[model samples]
Target: MNILILGSGGREHCLAWKLSQSKKINNIFAIPGNAGIAQIAECTALPINKDNFPSILEFIKNNNIDFTIVGPEAPLVEGITDYLEGNGHAVFGPSKDAAKIEGSKVFTKKFAVRNNIPGAKAYFFKKNDYEKAKEFIEGLDAASYPWVIKADGLASGKGVLICNSRHELLEALKDFFIENLFGKSGEEIIIEEFIEGFELSIMCICDGKRIIPMEPAQDYKRIFDNDKGKNTGGMGSFSPLPFVDNVLQKKILERIIFPTFESLKKEGIIYKGILYGGIIIKDNEPYLLEYNCRFGDPETQVVLPRLDNDLLELLVNAGTGNLGSTELAWSAKKCVCVVIASKGYPETFSKGDIIYGIKDYSNKSDTLVFHAGTSMDKGNIVTNGGRVLNIVSQDKTFNGAIEKNYNKIKNINFDGMQYRNDIARKVAEK
Candidate 1:
């Protein structure tokens, strides 16, 4: 079957790589794919975005693509699935209505309340109601020193800020409401009470009814090591978290995932494709932090590597609502994905620097360098975005996987490359 994936990041590259390995797949394509994806699938250089849906539809038809999978949230939030399905095409993603769970934090918060889904305590405030927001924060005791201030709309993972004090929370609000730091994304805000806990990602395949949960993966969102600094998409990730036992998994499925599915159903929206739960576990209980309509970036880089089944067939069946009869298999090996980013990522950084030492990785066992922000410039691969590449490796043990990944990561270098050295350190120690 001919498949077309949308996006130009490591997640899309991993999906393309997995699909290329499928025996049933005849051809695969990616729109605006990075350099690494080009190695496995036909990378079509198209300016794909929300407004250019018509052009993408034409491309799908011309290429005779049997299935189209969206890898990013932007297009899904912009109603790409509805547009494609309306035009009689097979597409894998949630509708614009269903995507609100990821597109709008305020929407998800309200939905969570209505559905009795477990989550952190939050209060909604619009830009015009700045005084109300300040008053709400002032009302909180000193115990809530670290407050989570989030922009209601998507801001590429930088929308949420953890304020260490009242002064910081006030400053963040001023930036959002007064300074307009995030533009339209910050027009509205959600001041959620901060919950201290270990975070993990739970991705599931939902065929609008039955939900098939994948293995748990924990990602380090902070830009620096030891979980410090601002969030930048994600820094690194690992699968088979030592903390997520059967009890915790069952709680997440029953308390969060099921209600989320039922909530979407109540709204008359059949949520197909991936439903990623950004969860925080505290006191042996799970709390929903956020949701992504599609797959997680660095998390997918690690999770997909541990899959023992054909990814192409699983996604296709889910897209067609035939996933009830299908089952997925996973390898026992632990997987780790360390993100290589520009030196000053999540802030200011340089691009166009020549990257080296990736081509040699093909000879390495169980190691894959999935490109995130890269492009071929005059026969040389160069950095093109903040998070550049994902160094993924798998082994029988989590510590072994982490060791193997970091060893190979040292060989690959760009002018301003940076990565976390202690990825999955806490979990691996246990």
Candidate 2:
């Protein structure tokens, strides 16, 4: 089958890596794909932006692209799925309207509140409504708790603000709204009461009716250990968290996952593709923090390696509206993925630094490297984005997997490459 995968990042790379293993796949094309994806599939520089929708559609029709998978939320938010399916094409992503669950934080928050879905209370505000913002923030400070300020629209993944004082929060608002740092994404904002707990990421596939949950994975987004520093795209991740036992998983499914799908269905939205529910387990309570329309970058890297089913068939089923009695299997091995990034990430960082050692590092040990934020400059792979490669390793034991990945990292090198070292240390400590 001819497949067109959209977006350029580690998540796309991981999907390409896993999907290429399926014999059902014949020809695969990645639009604006990174250098790493170039190894697994034919990488093309096809314009995937909304403005280039006609060209992309024409290419899709002409190439007989049997299926299309969108990797990032940008084009989805811009209605790429709606356009393609409207033209009678099969696209593997949510429609623009369905994507509102992830596109607008305020919208989803209101939905959760209306449905009585367990989550933190939030105060929404428009950019021009400074008085209300200040009033809400002051009330939060008087309550004496850290509140999370989130840009209601998509700002990549760095739009979330966890502030200790009202001053830092108000300053963040000035930078977000007045300075327009996040562009039109900051046009609206929501201040949520910060809930303290371990954050777990749960992704499920929906065929507009049936919801199939994948194995839970936890991703570390902070730049430092113990959840400190600014949130980057993602630092590292591991699959099959030990915290959520069978009972906890059942509760999450019954309370949050099942009700959420029902709510979206009630709204007449065909909730297909991936739905990421970021849940915080506070005092043993699992509360929905936010939703993402597509797969998480580093999280996908770890999760896909554990799948024992044909991913290509599963994705096609999701797009075609029939899951086809599919049941996913997994190995007992735990997978850990560590992201190797540029020195100054979630901020300004230089690119084009030549990465070395990967040439002799493929299929080595339990570690598999998927490239992100990289490009083939002539013949050498060089940095292209903040996080460059997701180095994944697996073992029967969780600690064993973490050990293998960090040890494998020593074999790969690039100038000014930065990576988090504290991944899975919590599990290791016990």
Candidate 3:
């Protein structure tokens, strides 16, 4: 089968890498893929964001591409899945209506509230509410420090700010409303009471009817280790969190995950594709942080490698309603993923820095490198975006899985490559 994947991040690289290993696959293509992906799949230099959809439709028709998978949020928000399938191509992301689950935090808050899903209480605001927002923050002086302020729309993953004090929250809001840190994305805002807990990403495949959920993975979103600094796209992750035991997983499914699907169903939107449930697990109770319409990035690097099932088959079956009878399989091995990010990331970061470790991976059995932001600079691979690569390694033990991989990370070199030192150390410390 011929397959086309959208976006050029680590998630796409992992999906491409995994799908390429499928015995049933004939050919695979990545739209504007990075250097690492070019090694496995046919990297089509099409701008997947804008003009490529029309070209992609024609290419799928001409090449007999059986399936198309979207890897990022932007195209999905533009209804790329609805278009591809409308033009007789199969896509693995949600429709535009379903994509709203991720595209707009305001929309997600409304949907969750309407459906009675458990989450932090939040209030929305427009640009005109700057004064009102100031008053609200001042009133919250009696509450607690570190208020959570978020852009109502998508500003990548860094749009959510966890401010430490009323002064800091006030400053952040000023930059957002006045300095335009996120432009129109911050035109409207959602201020919520901060929820402190361990965050877990639970992703499930929806076939527009039934759902096939995958293993839950935990991602460290803060830029620094020990959960410091601002939120980034994500710094690192690990799979099958020992924290998400059977009891907690069951409760989360019943409280947040099931009700989410029900709400979308009530709207007549059949969510076919990945339903990403971001849960803040605290006090052994799960609170919904957010929902992503597709798979998580670095989390995918760790999780997909442990998938013992045919990925392409699962995606097609999910799109076709055959998933109801199918059961997904996973490897017992523990997977750990560490992201190599550009220096000064989640802020000002330089690009075009030559990265020199794509081929430096050791001869380890369960190791794979998935590129997030890299390009071929006349032959040498170089950084093109903030978080560049996902270094993944697996083992029977979680500690053995991550430690082995992070040691190899030191061998790799780039001008401003920055990564978290403590990935899965929480589990390690335990």
Clashing pairs counted in every model: 0, 0, 1
Q: Which ten-residue region of model 1 has the weakest summed lDDT?
A: 358-367
The 0-to-1 C-alpha lDDT of every candidate, in the order given, reads 0.88, 0.87, 0.86
The lDDT leader among the candidates is 1
Q: Tell me, what's the RMSD of every candidate?
A: 1.6, 1.7, 2.1
Query: Which residue runs does candidate 1 get wrong by more than 4 Å?
Result: 360-364
Candidates 2 and 3, the one with greater lDDT: 2
Residue pairs clashing, model 1: none
Q: Candidate 3 at residue 284, lDDT? A: 93
lDDT of candidate 2 over 74-140, digit per residue (tens): 8998999999999999988898988999999999999999988999988888988987787777666
Candidate 1 per-residue C-alpha lDDT over 256-290 given as tens digits, one digit per residue, 9 for 90 to 100: 99889987898898999999999998999999999
Superior by lDDT: candidate 1 or candidate 2: 1
Weakest lDDT window of 10 consecutive positions for candidate 3 = 357-366
